[model samples]
Target: MIPQRKLSLLSNRLARKGGRRVPEAVLERDYCLSWFLVGLSKTPLIDILAFKGGTAIKKCYIPDYRFSEDLDFTLRESVPFEKIQAYLALAFENVEKDSGIKIRISRFDQNVLGLTDLPDSGL
Candidate 1:
């Protein structure tokens, strides 16, 4: 769990640096989602997919990369939608239970191809 003081300090520092208010909820949402992605990456399911884009960079490659609002991946081959959904459902459940942060997953036909949409977390 992230310390409340640490989170407060982060938000304060960010707000000062950017010359604007940094909502603590946004920080916490990003933190929670990143934690959930960490758990997702450990699975064999994700190993078959090629992670890409800014969110992938932030989570998998560059820790200090810029903030990204979305996750992207490329599949070498097709997998059943239900399989993908089930794996993520279990993973998100574990993440929520452990972190005490609810992660809601849903598909909205907003992105092209197989891009799965992450629903509003209501953070």
Candidate 2:
């Protein structure tokens, strides 16, 4: 669970800019997704091109964006398109069920897929 103090600080910053702060439930879902990716990265099925947004910014971006909710990763060129789609669907389903939000995943290419939308409620 995210520390209450840290969540408050993040909430304050997002409120100041009229940005929606991620809910605690959503944060937990994000954590789960992160670990899933980490585990998958060690496998040979996919290359895990990039895990961008919050974690990436925290580790790579000079001045971090402070908050990010989605996980972004790429598949290996040799991986079949069907497998990529299946993985994303399952990942998004897990996140949506856990967070009580609706997540939509889309592919820009055979190897590049993204979490397109996450509704505020599981609508």
Best by lDDT: 1
Q: After superposition on all CA atoms, what RMSD does each candidate show versus the true structure?
A: 9.0, 11.6
For candidate 1, the lDDT comes to 0.72
Per-residue lDDT of 25-93 in model 1, one digit per residue for the tens? 767768876777766765656766777898888776786667776667666667777777787787777
How many clashes (backbone atoms < 3 Å, residues ≥3 apart in a chain or on different chains) does model 1 have? 0
What TM-score would each prediction reach against the true structure?
Answer: 0.67, 0.41
Go through the candidates in order and give each one's C-alpha lDDT.
0.72, 0.55
Candidate 2 weakest ten by summed lDDT: 105-114
Which pairs clash in the backbone of model 2? Answer: none
Off by over 4 Å in 1: 1-6, 15-22, 109-123
Tens digit per residue, CA lDDT, model 2, 1-123: 457777677667756775566565655555555555544444443454545566566445644355455555544344666776676666556545555445564435333334544446756
Task: Write down the lDDT that model 2 would get.
Answer: 0.55
